[model samples]
Target chain A: MTGQDFPEPGPFATLSGAEVDLGRLRLRLVAEAERESLLDVVYRTVDAPVGRLLLAATRRGLVRVAYEVEGHDTVLATLAERISPRILKAGGRLDTVAGQLDDYFSRARSGFEVDLDLRLASRFRLTVLEHLREIPYGSTASYAAVAALAGSPRAVRAVGTACATNPLPIVVPCHRVVRSDGGIGRYVGGDDAKRALLRLEGAI
Target chain B: MGREPFEVVVERYGPMVLRVCWAVVGPTLAEDAWSETFLAALRAYPQLAPDSNVEAWLVTIARNKAIDQLRAQSRRPAPTERLPESIRWEEPDAGLDLWDALRRLPRKQRETVAYHYLAGLPYPEVARLLGGNPASARRAGADGIASLRNMLAPSAREKGPR
Candidate 1:
C-alpha cells in the first residue's frame, strides 16, 4: 500500500519486517493439528472432467465430494454447521483421494478403495446407496432394482432421492443408478456429468 | 448468523499475529506462540461475536501465549555463562536492527509498542492488555519509540559505515 503512495518514513513499518515463511508455517500447523487431534476437517480441490471437485475429509475418512455446480463455499458452510468449524486446506491431506479421483476419471481405476464417511446421509438413503455401489463398475442397475435390494422394494422414489443426494458421488458409485424405462434419468451432478461418467465407464 | 471457514481467519491474521509475537517474545518463541494462538482461537471461534475485531482478539491470545513461553524459558538454567559467544543470526543492514531493540525495552513498553505499532491495535485495547488507561498505553509506546530512536538514530550516521 505504501508503494502506491509515497513511501512514508518511520520505524513502525520496518520494525516487523522479518521474513515469515507462511507456506512452511501452514504445513507445520497441519502437522501440529493432526498431532493434537484439533483438526476437524481438511479439504482440497482436484481438477477433473467434472470441473474442480471439492474433496472434504475428517480424520475418520473421506466425507464429502462436491461438484463445482454445488458451490464449494456453500458446501463447506454446511459442513461447518453440521460438523466442526475447524477446517483447513491442508494440501497433502486429500492427496490419496485426489489421485484416486484422477484414476477414476482417467479410467485407470474402476472402483474406489479409499475410506468414506457417509454419516451425512439418512439411514434408508444410506441403504439405497450401499446397494447402489454393488451394481459394479461399468454397469447399471435400475433405481427400482436398487430399492428392492435395499429392502424397500416399493420405494423406488426413495431410491432416486438417495442417489440424488449422494454425498460421496463417484467414489460411492451412485452414478450407476438409472431409470428402469431405459433412460439416463437425473443425477446429483446434472445429467450431462452423469453421461460423461457413464461414457467414461463404457456403460453408455 | 454464519461463521467463515477457519482457514480464512488464519490466512487473514496469521502473519500479523506472528509479527506481533516476534516483537513481544523474539523469533525463537514466536512460531510456537502463533501456533497456540490460532489453535486456541479455532477452538472458540464459533462463539465469538461475528462483528468482533478478529485481529485484536488474536493479538491478545498471542500476548498471553508469549508470556507463558517467556516464563517457561526463564525457568531453565541461564546458558549465557556456559557460552560467552552465543550463536547469533546475521544482523539487519540498517536502523536499530529492530529485533534486538524491541527486546531491550521493558515488557510493558515492548508489548504496548508491539500491539499498537506492529498489530495496529487501538490504544484502548493495548491498555486492556497492559492494565492502564489509553493515555498511559499511548505514553508507554511513545516512550519506547523515543528510547529506540535515541539509541538508533545517532548511531545511523556514525554506525552506518561501520
Candidate 2:
C-alpha cells in the first residue's frame, strides 16, 4: 500500500562535476527525483491490478491510462493536479472494455467497441485518435496514413507525435500504426512492448 | 513467539528468497511473497521441526503463497493492460539466454527449475516444498533441466567452449 513496497530506480554515486562537492549536490537531486518517481509508481499501483500504467501530459491536456491496474487514486491525483478534478475511475464503464480486451488477447475479438473520454485532448489529437481508431483489428497503418486520415496528409510527424503521446494504446489501437518502411516505430512504452502488442494482434 | 526482525531475515537471505519467488511467480509478485514468506516463517519458526531444513521450509511457504496468488489472478480474468506498475517487476535475469526460452513451460516445470536450479534446492527438498512426492520433484527437476539443456545447447554450442 505504501510507495516503499515498489522498487524505485536505485541510487548511484557518480563521479561528475568539476568540483567534487558539486557532485554531492547532483547526487542528492538524483536521489530525490528517484524517490519521487518511485513514489509515483507505488501510488499509481495501489488500486491497479498488475500491469502497465501510463501517465501522459500534452501541451494542452493530460491523460492517465491504467492498464490492468487496481487503484485509481494515484492516476486520479496526477490528472487532478495537471488537468481537472473531474477524474472518474471508469471501472464500471470500463467493464465492457475489459471484456473486449480479454477477447482480443484470446484472439476472439477483433475490434474495440468502447466510448472513450477524449475531451482531455485538443481538436487535432482528438481527430487523430478517431482516425487511428479506424485502422482496423489485426492490421496496422503508418503514421502517414493516420495523418492523411486526420485531414493533413503532410502531417506524418504530427501523427507520430500524437501516437507517442497517446494515453491509451490497445483501446485506441495505436499498435496498428507502423513505420512507412515496414518497421515498428518507437512507442512511448518501448518498442518491444509495441512489438508484443502487434504480435498479439497478429499484425506482424 | 513473535515476528523475527525483518531486517535480519532480509539481510540474511533476501536475494535467495527473492530468487525462489521470482522463479515460481516472476518478479511481479515476488515482493509480496517475500515479505509474507518471512512473516510466515517467523510465525512457524517456533514450531519448526529441529531437523528440517529452514530454507526448504521457507521455500515451501513462498511456493504456496505464489501459487495462491496466480490462482487468484486467474479467477479475476480482467484485462492485464491496466495492471499497476508496482506489481510488475522487470523480467528476471536468469543469467542465461535459455531463460527466455523457458517462457513456454507449464507453470509446474517453471517452478521446478526455479526451485531446483535457480533457487539451488535439492530435488527432494523441492518436492517437499511443492507438496509432491520426492520422485515427482526429482522428475520435474530432471525434466525441466533436460528441456532447458535441449533448448539451450545449440546456443551454448554456438558460443563454442566457454
Candidate 3:
C-alpha cells in the first residue's frame, strides 16, 4: 500500500501503535549528535572530508570545509593540536569549488569542473584526483588509466590506492574510475553504495 | 542552560538527528552526519542559549550538517547522476527501518520529508533551512510524499493507500 497520508499530519495516538518506536528513534538521533561533538573536541576539522562538510572562503579563495560543526576556532584548535600543527585559512581558495558543489546537488549540474585546492592531499594523489575531475559525466575509467594519467603508467595498483585514499571523491569522480577490464570495482563507500550511485547517474 | 546529563540529551534526541540525516542525505551519508552532529553538539553544549529549544537547535545544526554532507558528496565522483537513488526512499518505520527507505530518496525530496515530519518544522521554516522559498518547500514535500507512496505501494495488483 502507498505510504501517503491525509493532508494533515497523522493522528499518532489514533493510528497504529508506533509511538514507542518513534520516541526511540528521536533518542538515538540526539545521542549521535552528542557523540559527534565529543570527537571533535580533540581532532581539528580538515578539508580532508571527515564527517559533514561546509565549504566556505574569503574573496581570496576557498578557505576550508569543516568536518565538525563547531565554530572555526574550535576546529582550528583541533587542527593545531592534532593532524598537522601548521594550518592556514587562505581566502577564496575554495569558492569556485563550493559554488560548483552547490550547483551540482540542485540538479543544475551533471559534473564538477573546477580547480581544487588539493594541497590537503599528497602530490601524487592530487595528480590522480586532477585526472579524475576530468572524467566526463556518466562515464568511467580504470585504475591503470588513472595511474598512467598521473604519470605512473605501471602503478595501476597505486592508482587504485590513490582513488581509495582520495580526500575528494565526487569532485574527483573516482567512481567513474573502475576496474581495468569491467565491473564497478571496490569503493570505500561500499559496492552497493557505489552501484547505487552509478544507477542514480545511469552509469550502470 | 543547565548542563543536563549528556546521557539525558542522547537518550532524548539521538535518533532525531539520525532520522533527519538519513532523510536528508540517506543512509550512506547519515552515519557520518549522525556522528558529526553529536560531536558538534557536544562542543557547542556549553554555549547553547539557556532559553533555546534544544530539540530545534540540535535539529537545525543537524539539518545544516546534513545539507553540507549532501553538497560534499556531490563533488566526489559517483557513478550516478541522481545524488540519491529513489529506491532509497521508504516510510519511517519501527526499529528505525524507515531510514533505509528514506535513504532511497533524492537529497532534496528526502530533506523535505525530514524537516516536515521528523523535525516537525513548517513549510516556511523548512524553506529557510533548505535555502529555498515556501512554495518550493511545499512542492518538494508533496513530491516526496507522492514518491514515497508510490515506492511503498505493492505491485499493480495490490491495494493502494486509502
Candidate 4:
C-alpha cells in the first residue's frame, strides 16, 4: 500500500494514541509484579552520604547494597545471573529498607531495622557476614577479630575476602571491619565509600 | 559483550511488545500476554546473543505468548457478552474501534501487520517469526493495511476535522 492509502498519522500512531505511554505501562507492570510477589529481584538507587548506593531486595529481605564504583548495571546483571533472571527496577518493594537507610544516613538512626537476605553468601562467608552485622554501628573490628568471631581464627584472610564480597555492605556494616593496624582497610565499596560510611557512623 | 540487565530489555521493548500483544489478543488478554512474554524473555535473556535484534526477539516472544493466550481462550467456554469491568485502552475515543478492526483481520494478516508495522520489524524478520517467505509476509502486511484503511475510511470522513 502506498503512503497516501494509509491514515495521515499511520495506523501504528493512531493505535498508540496520546494516553498509552508505554513507560507508564512498564512501571505499572513492575508494580503489579511487586504486589503479586512475582518480582524475584527489585532494586532502586539511593543517594546516601557515601554517593549513590544500589539497593536490591528479594521478597526474603534486603539482599545487596552496591556502590557506584561497583557499576550499578554490572551489579544488576550479576544479580540476574545468580538469582532468578526476573529482575525489575521497582522501588515500591524497597520502601521499608530505603526508609531505614535514609534514617541511618542522616544519623537519625544508629542501626538498620530491615531484614537481611544473605542468600547470596554461604558457609564461612555466611558466618563472616553474620559476624559483620554484630560489629555495632559505631565500633570497628579488625579482620582478625572478625575471623575469630566467625569461629575460624586463622581465616583472617577469608574474613577480608568476606568483607570485600559482602553483599549488603552498609546495612550489614562491612565498613566496620578494619585493619589490625587500626587503619581503615580495602572495601567492596572502595576505600572512599568505606571511609564515608565510617565517618557517618562516627567510627572514624 | 556481556548481556545487559533484563530491566533494560523490558524498558526498551515494552511498548512494542504491548502493542503487538494488544493487536494479536485484544485488550482483555493483552496484559496477561505482555506479562508472560517479558517474564519468559527475562528467563531466557542471558542465553540471548548480545548482538541479537532485541526488538525482533521481543516481538517473537510476544507472538508466542499471544498465541498461547488465544489457545487458552478458545478452550474456555464462551460467556455471554457483557461490558468489561476494566478496559485498559488509555484512549477510549478511537483505540477500541481500531482494536475491533484489527481483531477482524485474517490471523496471518493481523500477525504480519502487527509485527511489521507496529513492532517495526522488516518483512524478512516478520516472516521469520510468522513463517512463510518475506514476499508473502509483505503481501499480507499490505493487504492488512488496505483492510484497515477501508474499515476506518467511513469513520474518518464522518468525524471530519478531529
Best by DockQ: 1
- Return the top candidate by TM-score: 1
lDDT tens readout by residue for model 3, B62-160: 987887887899899753322222122233342233444455677777777777777667777778877789888888888876766565544511454
User: What is the DockQ score, from 0 to 1, of model 1?
Assistant: 0.31
Residue range B1-162, candidate 4, lDDT tens digits: 556667877777776677778888877777778878886776677678878888888888899999999999899985443322223445564666777678779999999888877777778788888789989988998899888787767776477442
lDDT (C-alpha, whole model) for all candidates: 0.79, 0.56, 0.58, 0.80
lDDT of 3: 0.58
Q: Give the alpha carbon lDDT tens digit for every residue of A81-151 in model 2.
A: 44432222213234455566667767788876665556555677778988888887778898888998899
Per residue, candidate 3 scores C-alpha lDDT tens digits across A1-204 of 123322343321111222323343334443453334232221112242223454432222232344333355554543333332222222234545666655654556787665444545677877887788777877778888888778899988878887776645556677788897797898755566567556656778
- Please identify which of the two predictions, 2 or 3, would achieve the higher TM-score against the true structure: 3
Model 4 clash pairs are none
Could you tell me the TM-score of chain A in candidate 1? 0.89
Determine which window of 10 residues in candidate 4 chain B has minimal summed lDDT: B80-89
Q: Compute the lDDT for candidate 2.
A: 0.56
Instruction: Estimate candidate 1's alpha-carbon lDDT, on a 0 to 1 scale.
Output: 0.79
List the lowest-lDDT window of 10 residues for candidate 3 chain B.
Answer: B81-90
**Poorly placed runs, candidate 3 (over 4 Å):** A1-204, B1-3, B75-106, B156-162
Which order, best to worst by TM-score? 1, 4, 3, 2
Candidate 4: give the TM-score of chain A: 0.88
lDDT of 3 at B53: 76
Better model by DockQ, 3 or 4? Answer: 4
